[model samples]
Target: MRQNFILQVILSILIVTMPVSAETTIYRFTKIIDGTGEALLARDIAVESGIIKAVGNNLDRSSNGNLVDMGSLIALPGLIDAHTHITYGLPEAPKGNAWGELGATTREQRVAAAKRNALLTLETGVTSVRDLNAGGGIDFELRDAINAGAVRGPRIFTSGPGIHPANDPSPEGTDKTTPEFLKAAAEKRIESGADWIKIFGTTGSADDLTSRAYYSAAAIKAAADVAKAAGKRITVHSYGIEAVDAAITAGVTSLDHPVGLTENHIKAMKAADIIYVPTIDHNRYYAQHSEEYGYDSNVRANLRVFVGRNIETVRRANHAGVTIAMGSDAVLTGFGENTCELRAFIAAGMSNAEAIKSATLNGAMLLGQDNDLGRIKVGYTADFIAVSGDPLTDINAIISGVTAVMKEGVLVVDHRTGGKVNKPNCGTLY
Candidate 1:
C-alpha cells in the first residue's frame, strides 16, 4: 500500500510539471500578402506549435492538423503598431486640462486602460506593438502579463519610461538632467527587463507643438550608449526639427514625430539609416475627438495643421529614401484605429503595398522581430489576419476591413456572421 501511494504521488508531480504540447493546424486562405510586396494566391499554411511549418497550395494532404479554410478572405501578416501608450487613462473618462492631462491619471485608471486597449488592439488585427510612453513601471508589468498569458493583448516590446526632465508629466517624477543621471536611468530600465530605452528629446505634444530641445546631445547620447551596452535599442521622441541632429548623433534606432525637416536633416537620417516613424494620423485622431478631451476649436485646428506638417515631412523623407515605419501613437480612443496611420502613409506618397510594409515588415524590423512576427514564411510564427478586400490595391481593406484575426495559431476574434470563428465552409474544414 505504501509503495503504491508513493508511486501515485510521483506520477501526480510529473503530470503537474509536464510541458503542454502545442497543436498543429492548417489554415487555407484565398490570397496572402507575404509582407515583402509578394502576394501569393490560393495559399494554404501549415502551423505547427504556433509556427509556420509550411506555405503552399494543397497542404491539406501532407499536414496533419485541424484545417480552417478562410473562405474568400485575403490573408496578410499581422499588423504591428510601432508606437502607443496603451497604459494611459481611459478614453471614456476624459479629464482634459491645459496641457498636462496625461500626468494626472491614477494607477488604477492606467491599468484599466491598458486592459481595455489590449483586447481592442488584438481584435483590430495588430499582433504586436512597441509601447513607448508609460509611467510608474506599469508598462513592464503589462508586458509580462501578456507574455505569461495572464492577459490577452498584442505582443509588447516596451520602454518602461522615457528619460525626460521634471517638467515632462507623462513619465512621473523629476530627474536630474545630467548625462550621468540619464545613463543611470537607462541602466535602471534595463535591470527592470525593459526592451528599449527612450529619450524625450523635445518638448511638444497636444495643443503645444513647439520643438524645443529638451535634452542636450550629450544627454541623449549617454542614454543611447547605455542602451547599446546592454544590447538594447533606443528611440527618441522629437516633435520637430530641433532635436533631429542630436538624435542622429546619438545613433538611436528610430526617430518619432519630427516635422519641418530640411533636406540636409533628411539626408543625414537616410545616411544614418535611422527609421522615421511619421505618426501623422495620431494628430487626426486627437483633432477628431477633441471634444472628448475638452479641447476648444483652436486646439483642434492646431492639430489639423500639425498633421499637414507631419505629412509634408513624411513626403520629403520617403522621397529622399528615408525608411518610414507606420506608428499610430494611439492613446485614449485611438486604440481601435491603430492601423489608420497607413492611410496617412498613403497620403504621404507611399503606395498601398509600401504602407502595408511599414506596418508589417518595417514594424517587425523595428521591433527586431523580423524573423518571427512579420511574414507568413515558413519558420515564422503563425500571426496573420484575414481581411475582406485586397489590401494591396485599397489601403482601407486593412485599415478598416480586418474580418478575422489569428494570433499564434489561435482564432482570437472572428467577425463573420453569428459572431463565430468558423464561418460557413470555413472553420472546421475537413
Candidate 2:
C-alpha cells in the first residue's frame, strides 16, 4: 500500500509538469498574414508547447487539442506598440507643465497604474511594448513581477526613467542640473534595474520651459557611456536639430520625437543604424482631438505647432531612407488612437506595407526580441491578433476591436459575445 501511494504521488507530479500530449492544437482561419511582409493567405496554424510548430495551406491537425475555427477573420502577428506609458494616464497639466508635473507618488501606486494599463494594452492585441517613461524603475519592477507570474501583463521592455539634461530648467527653486548630477542620476537608474536608458537631450517647449535648449554633446556622451558600460543602449528624446546632432555624437541607439530631423541627421542615423521612433500618433491625435483630453484653447494653439512640425519632420525622414519605427505616445486621451499613427505614417508617403512593418516586425526588432516575438514563423512564440476584415485592404481594421486579443498559446481575451473570461488558474493540477 505504501509503495502504491508513492507511485500515485509521482504520477501526479509528472502530469502537472508535462503538457497533456505532444499533439498540436490547430487554429484554422480563412485568412492569415504570416508576419514576414508576405501576402496574406488562407491557411491553418498549428501550435504546440506554446510555440507555432507549423503554418501552411493544409496543416495536419489529427491530434486532439482545442480547435479554434476563425472563419473569415484576418490574423497577423500580435501588434507591438514601440512606445507607451503602460501606467499613468494623461492627467490635467497646469498651465506651465504638460502633465509631467504630477506629484511624486509611492512605487506601489505607480505599479498599480502600470498593471492596469498593461492588461488593457494586452487586450488590444499589443502583445508587447517598450515603456519609454515611468516615475522610477518601478516600470521595470512591474515587468519583472509580471514575468515571474506575480502579476499579469504583456511582455514589457522598459526604460525606467526619462533622463534629462542637468542644465535644463527645473520647476521653481529646484537646484540647477549639472553633468555630475546627471551622470549620478543615470547610474542610479541603471542600478535600479533599468532595461534601457532614456535620455532627454533637449527641453521641449512642451515642457514648461519654452526654450529648446539641448544638452551639451559632452553631457549627452556621459549618459550614453554609463548606459553602455551597464550593458544597455540609450534612447534619446530630441525634437530639435541641434539636439539631434548631440544625440548622434553621443552614440544614442534610438531617437524619439525627432521633430526636426534634418537631412544630415537622417544620413547620420542610417550610417549609425540608429532607429527613429517618431511618435506621430501624439501629434496626429492631439491635433484632431485635443478637446477630448481637456486641452483648452491655449493648449490647443500650442499643439498646432507640434502637429505641423512633426508632419514635416516625418516627411523628411521617410524621404531619406532612414529606418522609422512606430510609437504611439497614446495616453488616456489617445487610448484608441494608436492606429492613427499608422494612418499618419501612410499619409506621409510611406508604403502601406512599410507602415505595417513599423508597427509589427520593426517594433520587435527595436525591442531586440526579433528572433522570438516578431514574425509568425515556425518555433516563434504564438502572439497574434485577429480582426474582422483584411488589414491590408483597410488598415483601420486594426484599429477596431473586431477581435482584440493576445494569443500567447492561450486565449487572453475572447470578446465574442460571451461573458468575460478570466486568466487560467490551477484546478486541482490534474
Candidate 3:
C-alpha cells in the first residue's frame, strides 16, 4: 500500500512537471501554393515567434501554435506593388506645377498621408510597396513609422525626392532640375534615407501640357551616376524613345515606361539587362474610358497607340528573351480587383504563370529583397495570401477572395468577411 501511494505521488508530480508543447499557430490548408515555380501541394505551415517554423503534412498542431484550418484554399506569397505613389494621388494642379507642387507640399501633410495610405493598402493584401517619389523626403518618415509599429501597413521602400530639373513644367509637381542640380538633389534625398532614386528623363505627351522634347542622354546618365554613387539604383520615367535609350546607356537599373520605344530601344533594353515595368492598367483604362479619366482626345489617342504597341512590345521582348517584372500603375482600392492587372497581362498575351511570377518572385527581386521576402521557402518571411480557387489555372483567383494574409507569421487580414483579423500590432509579438 505504501509503495502504491509513492507511485501515485510520482505519477502526479510527473504530470504536473511535464511541459506543454508551445502553441505554434499552425495553418492547415487544403492547398499550399508556394511562390516558387514548383507545383502547389497539400500541407500545414507552422508559425511561431513571428517566423515560419515548418511546412509539411500532418504538422503537430499543439507543438507549434494555433491552428487555422483553411479548407481547400490556395496560398501564395503576398503581392508586391513594384511602383506606387500611395501617399499621394495625381494632383489637380492645372499645369506648370508638376515639379513645383511636389516640392512645395509640407512635410507634415505628406507624412500623414503616407501613414493613412499605408494602412489602406495593407487591408487590401499588398504586403509590400515601393513609394517612388515624395516632395521633400517624407517617404523616409513613412517607412520609419511603419517599421516602428506606429502604423498598420505594408513594408515601405521609398525614394525620398525624385531628382529632376527645376521649373520644368508638369502637373504632378515633379522635380525637374538640371543634371548638375539633379545629382546634388539626389544626394540630398539619399542623405535623407531614400531606399532608391527616381529620375524623370523624358517628357510625356500631356505631361503638364508639355509638347517640349525630353531631356538629353547626358543629363539622364548624370542622374544615374549620382544614384549609383549613393549605393542605390535609379528608376527612370521615360515616355519618349530618346529617354529610354539614354536611360539604358546611362546604366539606369529600371525603366518605367516604354511608351514610344523603337525596335532598337527594345534591343537595347534586352542587351543592357534592364527591367521594364510598363504600367499597362493606366493605358488600358484610358483606352476604354477616356471620358471617365477626363484626358484630352489627342492624349487619349496617343495612349491607345502606346497601349497596343506595348502589348506587342511585351510579346516581342519575351520572344527576344528580355526579363520583365509586373506592376500595375493603377491605384488599388481593394484586394479582389487587384487581379485585374494580371488579367490585363494575359489579355496582352503572357501566360498565366509568367504573369504570376512578375507579381510575386519578380517583384521581390526588383526590390532586392528576394532573400527574405518572396517565396514560401522555410527561411523566408511568412508573407502569404490564400484564395479559394487555383491561381495557377486562373490568375484572376488572386483577387477573388484573399481568404488569408500573413506577414512575418502574424495573420493580418483574414477575408472570411472581407475584413482584417485585427489591426496589425507591429510592436508586439504575442
lDDT of 2: 0.68
Higher-scoring candidate on TM-score, 1 or 3? 1
2 versus 3: better TM-score goes to:
2
lDDT of 2 by residue, 66-133 (tens): 56677677778888888887766533332333244334545565566667767767655677888877
lDDT of 1 by residue, 1-430 (tens): 9999899677644433332223557777888898875796437777777777777766655544567888888899998899988887553656555125656667887798898998888877898999996878788888889888899889899988777775233344654666787788788889978898888888887677888887778878998998998999999999998888988999989999999999999999889889899888888887777766778888888888898899899999988989888888888767787887887888889888888888888889898888998898878988999888898888878867788888887777788664633211101100
Q: Give each model's whole-structure lDDT.
A: 0.80, 0.68, 0.65
Q: How large an RMSD does model 2 have? A: 11.3
Candidate 1 residue pairs in backbone clash? none
lDDT of model 1 at position 61: 59
Tens digits of per-residue lDDT, candidate 3, 15-123, equal 3333324756667776776655455444677666656666665566335446677788877778777777765632332243333444465656556656666755665
Which residue runs does candidate 2 get wrong by more than 4 Å?
Answer: 1-23, 40-42, 61-66, 90-109, 165-181, 205-211, 287-294, 418-430
Q: Against the hidden reference, what TM-scores do the models get? A: 0.88, 0.81, 0.79
Best by TM-score: 1
Higher-lDDT candidate of 1 and 3: 1
